[model samples]
Target: LEAYQKFVFEEDRLRSVQIAHHICSLMQRGNVVVRWKLYHSVFNPVLQRGVKLAHHCQHSSVTSAQMHSCPHHDQCLPQEVLQVYLKTLPALLKS
Candidate 1:
């Protein structure tokens, strides 16, 4: 069972590498369809879910969407972290 699990994990890792390489090639070729599909199908949903969760716990008086201030810090939690994360698109693209 352990060997089988290891094999499966290795297979998954190889597949991930292959997928990344294929995506890189598509990017080099300037394939908008492939890039958009990767973002809309994969990345956008993940970001939307996280943003939804952030909004759900926010106080009504917070005013700004995800910009609600964290109680511990003077600045809004959303503005400080989530917005910052969203702004770092170049870093994400690098990954």
Candidate 2:
């Protein structure tokens, strides 16, 4: 049981890391123009969905351990992604 629990925990952590990395990759590939278009077009809807997902994934009864791995479909972006997003904020705000 201990081994199984460890395995599950590791899997969850890996999934969370993958999600974070994916978001970072998306940001890295995105240029200022692309980011703006993304912000205007895609991000809003994604953010809305993320909010709903957060309610379920972060706040629901499910174990935090599971939630970390089985991220809500809407809550795809991770904190790392948000960090990259913030790095672009000054330029975005200037524009």
Candidate 3:
């Protein structure tokens, strides 16, 4: 039971990380409405998954103490990509 739970947690975390990266890529090329839709459709779910992963890590006895050591903890979108996205978000929202 513990092993399976850990596996599922890791799987979800990896998938969420991939989605985060994809969202950044889409933001780089898509227009305002497209980005807006993608944010609502895709990014929200990834955010939820991240929240779930964090909760799981916090609750899991095997991981509670080592939460910060998890590789996936830092696997989300890169800083530069996120900065670019933030810079464009205001312009996109205005349009």
Winning model by TM-score: 3
RMSD in angstroms, all models?
Answer: 11.9, 10.3, 9.4
**Per-residue CA lDDT of candidate 1, range 6-45, in tens?**
2222324455344434433444455667556655553354
lDDT scores in order: 0.42, 0.48, 0.51
**Which pairs in model 3 have colliding backbones?**
none
- After superposition, candidate 3 runs with Cα above 4 Å error: 1-20, 64-95
lDDT of 2 by residue, 35-67 (tens): 655565544443554455556665666554565
Cα lDDT, model 1, residue 4: 27
* Candidate 2 lowest-lDDT run of ten: 1-10
Instruction: Give the poorly placed runs of model 1, Cα more than 4 Å off.
Output: 1-30, 60-95
- Provide the TM-score for each candidate, comma-separated: 0.33, 0.37, 0.44
lDDT of prediction 2: 0.48
Question: For each candidate, how many residue pairs have backbone atoms clashing (under 3 Å)?
Answer: 1, 0, 0
